[model samples]
Target: MRKFSLYMASICLLFGCEETIDVELKDAPPAYVVDAWINDKMETQVIQLSLTQPYFDSSEPTPITGATVTVTSEGKTFSFTESQSGSYTWDPATSTDRIETVGSRYTLTVNVDGNEFMAESELRRVPPVDSIKFTFKEERNAFQPEGYYAEFLATDPVGPGDTYWIKAIKNGIPLNNPFDLNIAYDAGFNEGGNIDGVVFIQPIQDAVTPLNEDLDEIVPYKLGDSLHVEIHSITHEAFTFLQQVQIQTQRDGGFDEIFAEPLENVSSNIMMMNENPDVQVIGFFNVSSVSGRGRKLTE
Candidate 1:
């Protein structure tokens, strides 16, 4: 009996001392992200903005519904209608039928779920093109098996340092794609918002040499030809500040910093085909990615 007792005690000691244990770690908290893109298609008569709902966790984003959205721009106000699948629509009228001043600024206001946001935009005017001429230059590129030269030119009354949208018309049709380039201002202050300059519409992929393709298709401007040009407004400075409202005991980084960045500038222009009146100009431009700190206008 004593030997059996001792054996039992030994078994209990071994088993109890060798007992297994387990533990599990909790996962990290999820993050939040939101993005808004301005629709390029709707520019003149209407401005459409699309908001994206980013994931808060590993799971898919839950739809945002029953939220009121309003936008104000250029002294005009518009509201959004909840469309299918997280889409919204609105059209705000401007103060005048014509586009605002080139340097004049426009403001955009957004409201969602008791939270508000704002963005600013600038309008730039397209400088007039003085003349269209051509020049010859030698080029050495492997892609161009044949030794070629470039010939193309469009002169603006104002020199470089300005942005422009250039287009061409061939055989009574406006070219869908026109080469867009920035002019370099030579020694001028870029003052008064005008520049006289020259630009060459080289053959596809040949910047130095104009490819001998369809002359009507390759050339953007012809001698003594009248062309259409457009320059957009721009804004370099942007900022936002947050306001705090105390609620529960939890002191969440009150009035913390949010998005602090400038938006991308945009411009569009119209080019006329002197020879082809049948062709028309259909173009658009706008700024986007507008984000900043949310400060109550009333506050």
Candidate 2:
């Protein structure tokens, strides 16, 4: 009788171990990062299917190796070849060597490791320059009783959000860098956080030793001084961040997984105008808002 009982107990233990080791199924697709951009000096150009590695929180970016990417437009097909693991180059000879025009639509298809991805975007057009003007600001100084500030005002007649870049040239030679003046604040409850402003600090040169008695010898910004203000063509980093979050959330399953993405696209686009390149416009501005309220905190 004891032998019989021992045999039953052994059978139960063996079955319990098998049950604990049962296989579980996961239905999630492999995550990937893809960065597509137009090459420098060419506005109508697009270099697509460049696989960026998965970010700190993102799934590994989809690899471009052995992947197929094609763009079709106006009856012409352009193909991209993966030159390396995550980067693909277009062959101008066979690819459509053309510029994407503003207001025109384009489609792109990418197949990586048998997974397909696609998107469409319009070549945006910026409004022509209406006017570039400046104004003076007043502030009290810690070293002096009073101080004067110089500020600039720009308009498009059409309104704000047209991206603009500022470049300033002082004393003849063209400055090497461009300054971006658009300043954005984080969304806060009380201040609306949407109010836009510029912060500028001027550098004062020391008076020459044994200098002349003329304290009124003044230097002024002259007209035709080559103040290069160019309309910026790059997509705003904020837009890119929001876009990535939207895409990741749509693809991911868990709530915490969806919230792990970063909130910055800070690619030299958010710098003060008074620094290195002297304050010239290299871009335009176009302000837009996402209509609905953000996701609820309770859920």
Candidate 3:
């Protein structure tokens, strides 16, 4: 009986144990990522190119080198030279004739290896920021005490569909987070809002206040801190893309997980001109007329 029991125990140990299974995840093909922007300043227009990395990659995206980039505007063609790794820049200082003006249409063409991509944007004018105001609020979150919140006093153009991308610069550092991304359509929160030809509404004005990334709460300003506000006139397409990006960032992981929208890629203006339809291009190209105002905190 002991020998029979030992034999059954040996069989159970050999067959009933957990086994590790190896998962072979197929590698996704790389896609070209283009982060290209042009403002009314037009000193040195830049376009950055890189290849998308895998989902689990913690490192920066791989930059694509040795590409031909060109921009055409006002019946003239301007070529860009590689100033750094995967970055192409066109300096108008070398030739004063290559200025980017409002209402001018600019076209970008890129050729890398055998793949080609093209995009076009028209510069739109933005309303000047008359002034900026701030208010101190009592403790709203347990993480921190009272903080300063900023608001803009600018009138929207008397036209419908006038979209904008508002950026905050605190002490020379740009507040670049999903929460800091403030976009308004026709002086309202978004396209659905009918407010126009007036000062920005309360919600739109309050959205520009900077927030702490680590604590995920509104950050108060210190004495002598400089706050600069920049407003960029952007296309409706660009506004939609940024809105989607904000939604994606906010829905990453929270109580709203069940109400999150379906995952979708950020729309890009660049189109593949090559015959290979399988090759994909990502990111956006934007041309904006920027207006800015700055103030320092005294109290």
Top model by lDDT, which number?
3
Model 3: per-residue Cα lDDT over 193-243, one tens digit each: 898899888777776677676635667787788889889988888888888
Against the true structure, what is each candidate's TM-score?
Answer: 0.35, 0.38, 0.86
Give each model's whole-structure lDDT.
0.33, 0.36, 0.81
Off by over 4 Å in 3: 1-25, 140-144
Model 1: number of backbone collisions: 15
- Candidate 1 all-Cα RMSD: 22.1
Which lDDT value does model 2 have at 89? 63
Residue 4 in candidate 2 has what lDDT? Answer: 68
Q: What lDDT would candidate 1 get against the real structure? A: 0.33
Best by TM-score: 3
